[model samples]
Target: MRLYLTKAALLAAASLAAQPAFAQESDDLIVVTGAPAPIAIENLPAAAVVIDVDDARVRGDISLDQALADVPGLQVPRSGPIGQQTSIFSGGFESNHTLVLFDGVRIDDPSTPESVFDAGQDTLGDARSIEIVQGPLSALYGSGALGGVVNILPRRGGEGALNPRLEIAGGSFDTLTANAGADGTLDRFRYALNAEGYTSEGYDIVPERIATHDGEKDGADITTLTGVFDYALTDSLAVDLLLRQREARVDYDPGIFGNIAENPGSEIQSDTALWRLGASWALSDALSLRLSGGALETDRVSSDFGVAGDEYHGDRDFADFSATWSITPEWTLLLGAQNEDENIEAVSFGSPVTGEQEHWGAYIATQGVLGPLDVTAAIRQDDFDGFGEEFTWRAGAAYPIGEAARLYASYGTSYRAPSLFERFVPFYGNAALDPERAETWEIGGDARFALFGQTEGLELGALYRASEIEDLIGFAGFAYGNVDRAEIAYAEARIALRPTDWLTARASYANTDAVNAATGVALARRPEESWSATLAAERGAFSGQISWRQIGSRLDTTYDDFGFWAGTAEVESYDILRASAAWAVNDEVKLYIAADNVLDETYEPVNGFAGAPASLLVGIRVTP
Candidate 1:
């Protein structure tokens, strides 16, 4: 069984690195997607990661790509199992070159064709954290941030009492889940709310193909809701509001290439909505002002059995304005303006299409601290009515190397624009595409000391990234062009440990080399090595976690025997393990248990699907 799960994950990492370390203390997190406010995380200079909500409640992660699958130059993938369709590749670009946000709006999907953003329809109840910044950010989010940016930070409420929560869960194909929430703060107003639901009965994501007899299976159902509101109106003003929604129905199976007909009643249904409004003003204490606006909508339907297949509608409206000047205390400045509009309607075979696009942007940025370094720079310009102009820039630096290390470097430029179903879909639209530029560079560092001699605390990090992608939109001889060009390089490493005071550990690694510099191939499902490890523990109220992940072999794209497009194949390598536990049957109750693919190792991340197996879950939670 893979050598007994690699000797039980090296004996649980050598018994958590041979225990015996104490004095644990932690908390040094603050991030805002690496800029535009909130900082710290070692002064953030890109290459970031956060994942809060207590790390998705100690790893019983549900969606958001299983809580970003051990982030580190991320690559999610997944085309089968739970809610199916998920993608998020970074550094190697593609998957719409990253960029996804929630609290601050923008959630791709402009009638697809690369307007990506679908982490299995995201869910982490009311989130509260999830940063992930990595590399190119289109000079502060614009176009699809070349290869990084994921925000999702919801849950907010202030002042005092009133807090409530509830949860329930069930497992193994025939899964179920439920959640509820509440938040507080009265004086000057503040609030938060959440709701969630899930259902599953999935399996047979191509169950070893058998020439298709569609034994039907492949299920999902989901629902979610979130809300937040804030108001101050004094002490320098404040106002904010947000709302979110999601709905889904999924099931699938049909093509695993060539012939293999057995539709088994395909399905897909979706709905999404988001809204935001905001205001903040300080105008002193180094000056400040902020404004925001947002909207997002998505609708979809696809069916096969009960007829009617294909229909989509998408929309987005956005606005933003910003200002900040801390012209002292080591200087800072930022300025911004943005607007976006997108619309789409699509229907299949019986034909029907509609499209719209609009964008405008302006930006400027600066940050400072000189002796011992910390610097940042930015620039942006965008205007795209018909894909006309674009400009992006970024610069970064960070240095510390003293009180427990820091060092960083960055360079960036990005762009993506080209999705209105790749420019008006009708016989495969193409209004003369353009806009797919990129350039990136990154360097990393991280350190934090005190290990073993007690006072536990350890952290280490490393990163290196490279990129090049020029006008690379694909799909030839039948529209959607800009032909191809791409190149990518990657390296990442991470470690975090706490040694005592009840365990904690983490590890990560990545090594990728994407290609396709115009047909040299190798970029399909990307994976040139990947890794992950995790362990968590808590005493006095019981808690637990264990995790492992791996992916290596890659390359996919096959289909011959009349289905055309025949070529690459190789999608081997795989490993996964998971476990979870919780108990706090006291302070308002809690109980949990979870297990997933604990060695039911059958792999296929794409290429004929089928991946997820061995599952179990049980849960309960309540708070007051």
Candidate 2:
């Protein structure tokens, strides 16, 4: 589609490459998840948000979910506290529809029944930023991206000098935590390493108000290790390596016989590791090529005192290659291919079951100035073992309004293939199920302006997006099947204020209207309305931040034990407030304290599961 194809529009877009999507907070804030390469926030016709996890230790954040609680339309739904079963609901899309990436590698689990990633279990260990790109992005990434992508970018070494850091904390609920990391650079190599561990007695997640509820507190013990190395073998070729591993033992309620959702002896122990090796080769002055290969291993076991336990093991091997041709200063072309193989096995009641899946994909894309608009177009073809072949395409354009404002729109198609566990799990599986396909379109704009006495910043951002999915997978009376179609419409309004350089404030309101086409009922666990706000300030050596969130009611279906339908359950709305304050004792040391659920409101986002309660933590850091 043409983007205001006029001579004036042409002049406007000629200098629109560097405008900020919301505000010019930093001229060097780079976002890499929106496209194949780093593109300006305003140049792409997609919606994206970047959340920084700087100094997480000083902020008393144990996991990445705490840093993401302020995101407008991204709802973190957890069955309990940290290390529990948790996922995110994005833009009213299904929980499993959101794909996650560590650096740039896919991390979706293949062993889980729904093939979903556990966002709650991932801790913020040496991460620099987290980027969220909204809408269907199947043209760039294949399955499990029907809603969007979440990429966690870690800090790298070799920038300049060597630095070392250590932190320790203890707080309410018998919690203890520690972190250590160092960054350094050598002759032609740079390296970074980080390790963190946490243990807590944990508060009880089963409320005493419910019948048959066990008052035993659920607890968690977790540890994470990260290593990154980069070597400049030559001027034209460079190699990099990444290794990450996490091990956890989490206690949870199993909702045993006659109990709403509690069991004293239920627990799970899991271990996961990821490793990747990548190299970039510049073949010529205008052409470059890149290649990477990686593998992920997962092992987990769950059980209760008197019940049968289950064990699961999964493995995934993946390889990717891409080429970039810089045709000119304003135009470029990208070609890429990806292949992945996954295998999983499970032991239930002393019976071992196994499954496998494979997929290959190739894509091409072009981007540059066209007529009066900056535009992009891409197409991809993916082949899966059971689903045969599927194709997806996307196109978008942006029109700038002089140097202060811009408008953009995009449309794309995406799909999700049936998981191996969904098709090979005993009598509950359905091998005949087909992949779910969907299309999405969005139009949004943001501007930069000055308020009070501040520099370039944003006053407002308006966005509206919609998606329609076909052949949604669901449970029938006998087995899983393609049950219904779903329609989703979302809109958000945001305002940011910078009264001065020392203080800032932001607030946003979002509405997600999603329903099933057949029954016209709202989707389960997708909140209809959400609100978020944050305020931060700095004075001398003291800094502080405050955040608040509100979520609306959600609807879900409850089922009986005999594989039969029961009734609908409504989850009520609630709000929470959190705050943090830090003080610099000197240039090499700092002290901080954080409080959660400051108002002490008691409510559950999910039925029968208790939310986190009021707690406080104090910590100290040493940097050299």
Candidate 3:
């Protein structure tokens, strides 16, 4: 411990000597997903977290799960490595309860077993920013947000000359990656494009001890492309376009399929295509109208023994219109409506079954300064063709405590309509299921204190959220049903301290308790305790970071020795360490190395599925 502390001291001193040449960056994280318009993070009454993708890339986080692993009250359990299925359980709610949006468009697939977004399938190479709003948000986003909302903003074209970026590399597991991006402006026209391809000869995510056959070296790969274009016709009118395509494939060791071996040439393939067009007009200083329409098509296929077993396809088409009225400098009102059509088809044993649904929703929100308090309120009415009517509302207030601190509280109601697959599938589905509903409230505050100078930003925040969910969908008597109630609560604390101009330390901790209200069974994958800490340093031309994360014990379903179905059991707690270093060779070039799971701790994230082992990667990036 003495040696480590002494070495760190010396490094900090050296880095600080060089830091005078490079200034600390300014913070410009104005979040939009939480409100009708962009607002500063500190002004938000609800607990929210915003992440910059550039920072994530520098820290060697390629996927969304890797980047969000440290977020409080969020759990991302990957069944395997890259390309494997991954799901998010936020605030102890189901995966489908959390809504995800990409470039302001919904991308969740309705054909999946749970009708949720696969957080693992896409890479964050093209994302510019991510906003995470914790607690219920269906009042603003409509259904499918009983837990929270995750919004990802793609890169936009910048003004002036073109900027191009390219990177190619290969590392452990015979992994290979290639990335390219370009953005520029041309008079009234602006455009941006990004592409990424990644492949890996991955090890068996399923351990031999729990498998029914010999382990096999699974392989996984993904390719994605995104494009954005904007044009201005007049000072008051503008148009924009967005296009995206993603394809992925992963080999898996399916456990005990009717007495069949686990690693029997099983694989899953998926493809997604999405596009959107939008137009905005400013009628006057007080009113602005925005309209957008988009479509998404997604499909998945699972194969074993060289034959396709099941195929699922889902499609969504939607149009949205909103008018923002600035009644006063300190007050605003936003009125919006959405029309959507979703369809799903599943082919099981060569028999195809299809289902379609329509959703219509209208919402109104107000944001203003009521006296010394920042206040916001919203209400939404939704009509599902298959179901009846639903209503939700949200209200929040923030009170300033002097210049550097604020106290905030929020209360909201949210809901999630059952998916097509969950309601109309073969024997496991129930057609009479009701929508899952939840009510949540939170209280939090933030304070900022400067130590040495502006470079040393010492910030602290803490929050506690309590929630109750009713009619939660659960598997009962061989079919899915809304027969359970649940309670969720979490206390989160965060700190970011810069003791020196060149050194920064950050940490977050969360203690969550989620359980079934009826039976008192703990929710799966939602750990009772978790924490993460990181130490980062930057100098004139060099930067480095070391991170430590820990996941606490939780109850998850276990399997039999032959990989057959079993009951729930307690899972052990585990910890992981990661480190990365980067060197800027010149104005437009950088070299870096990163190590994951440095201690090689053998742990299972989801029940019996094995997590990834220690790995290394080195790469160089060029921007010209």
Candidate number with greatest lDDT: 3
CA RMSD of each candidate after superposition: 24.0, 5.4, 7.5
Report the C-alpha lDDT of model 1 over 429-450, residue by residue, as the tens digit.
Answer: 7977998998988888878788
Going through the candidates in order, what is the number of backbone clashes in each?
Answer: 1, 0, 0
Give lDDT for model 1.
0.73
On lDDT, the stronger of 1 and 3 is 3
Estimate the TM-score of every prediction.
Answer: 0.33, 0.92, 0.93
| Model 2, span 122-188: residue lDDT tens | 8886676666677787777778888887767676774566878888888988898888999888878
lDDT by residue for model 3 over 1-624, one digit each (tens)? 000011111111111101101111135334231123434445668666667776677677777888777677789988778778788888778777888778667788878877777888788877876767667878778878878767676887886759899977667788887889999899888888999998998877666666454666777899999998878899888888889999999888765454324564888899999998888788887887778888999999999877898899999998887777778877877778888899998896576758888998888877778998888778889998777789999888888887788889989898999888878887787878889999999999888887767533888889999999998887988999988999988898988888888888999899989999888888888889998998999998999999999999998887666666677888899999999998999989988888889999988888667788898888888987
Best by TM-score: 3
- Give residue 39's error in model 2 in angstroms: 4.7
Candidate 2, superposed: residue stretches over 4 Å from native: 1-39, 55-57, 258-261, 306-308, 348-351, 557-566
Candidate 2's TM-score reads 0.92
Give candidate 1's error at residue 34 in angstroms: 27
